[model samples]
Target: MVFVESELGLHSELESVNAVKILIAGGFGVGKTTLVTTISEIAPLRTEEQLSALSASVDDLTGVESKTTTTVALDFGRITLSSELVLYLFGTPGQDRFWFMWKELSVGALGAVVLIDTRRLEECFSAVDYFESRHIPFIIGVNCFDGADVYDEDEIRAALDLSEQVEIRYCDVRDRESAKQILISLMEYLVAGANSGV
Candidate 1:
């Protein structure tokens, strides 16, 4: 429950607020969890587990060889966008073996942020295809790593074979402000699509 103070100096309880569902999706080790943790107002729920020997055959560790843990199910978080509006973030597990869960997580999502690591751009192709085929509004967030090569937005769009209508931006998932901006961009894009009847 939340309380809002009016101009009359009286507080009214807000028993129900508008909630928008947003999905954070990407390839393995693309920083989906980091983005959720950075912007969530509360303690984020993470279903992470250590990389086990059993997963060695199924999980690809190309650019993320240093990663020791992975999200097995999903990552959940929330952010209060305004007094009356809140955003619920659901992060899909990156491993292909867990991709069956994406459909369940995306049931009511309004939009999605497809995080991409420049070093492993090919890894996110599946996510892009998934959202596009479902006709879901999404924005591509190119996560800038410490030593990853930088590419212009146009180059990224071309590489992804994305249409001009799609939005793409570079971001640092570890930075709260950058992550927030990515979410805001997704919201703006959604609004634009709605207004244009696209």
Candidate 2:
């Protein structure tokens, strides 16, 4: 529990906390839903639908051949980062057809994490641009995948056109601990930005 010192110099537990909204965005098949499910305290709310043959013309599945389903709207989850802070995660649908929902989902968001799939690097450019255009503070999380080509931090940073100040962490969204750490890093970055008034 988080405690605050009252004017009387007595310590009291905090009962109320404002929940921050965070968007998990990325290109198609970048594991945004998986990341939310791995770290969410409650069962995640998924808006997924099976991919049919008609989807081939609209959705690009260049690197993610095995992906059978796609997030049609959004994936919702909740996580308690600290006793004083709770986060509401909204995972945006990755397809361009659903790009309309990104703006709606991003309303009042504190920041975002653009999950990256190294194999489909170009696919994430739209997500990165959306957050950048809105002036929202965000970080890149390299969602490491098995059998994917390895890319260094410098390479990713350059490829994404991110400044040196933007933090990047390697993680596998399927692993709860690894994904949680990336969230922790994002919270830390947000705190530091708040402290520095960035």
Candidate 3:
């Protein structure tokens, strides 16, 4: 448990604990907000706005193209897995135009989850590239959209040119259990990597 000495005799855990920051990053309408809300202990914070005419030219309108609201800034939420394991989840804005915020969003992050839309797999390239460039450990989750072609893990790995070491899998963002599984997979991957000093 996290503990801190306080003059104000009312002691509270987390008074001196450092939380691990984890980034949930992806392209437009990739279910980042849903995943954060599903697992966070607190209500997730999001900067969402209705789609304007100008957004059509920019945001992808293919699969979730009908999605009216989009997250503009970052989404923040907290989840405490154990007495000493608090996690701060930061959901990044997905539009490629907001690329400038990525570096700042990534600062001091333990790792990231790169969500991908199967219909627009190429859109995830930038997110993958960014993490790889910075050498931040991350897992790629293919957000399975209705009517989209289903690809096996091997096919996805080959198609994304993912190195053998990178973790890749499929997920359905709307399902809370599915989302939780994805996060658990990422946590395991990160813990294993840390133990191996990777």
In order, candidate lDDTs are: 0.90, 0.88, 0.83
The digit string of per-residue lDDT tens for model 3 on 2-98 reads 2222222334755655578999998888889888888776778988899999988877688775699988888888766555567789999889777
Model 1 lDDT-worst window of ten: 1-10
Candidate 2 residues 1-198, lDDT tens each?
Answer: 222322222245434556799999999999999999998888899999999999987888888988999999999998876666778899999989999998899989999999999998998899989988998989999999999999999999999998887899999999988888888889889989999999
User: Residue 114 error for model 1, in Å?
Assistant: 0.2
Query: Which segments of candidate 1 are over 4 A away from where they belong?
Result: 1-16
**Clash list (residue pairs), candidate 3:** none
Clashes of each: 0, 0, 0
At residue 4, candidate 2 shows an lDDT of 31
Q: How close is candidate 1 to the true structure, as a TM-score?
A: 0.92
TM-score of 2: 0.91
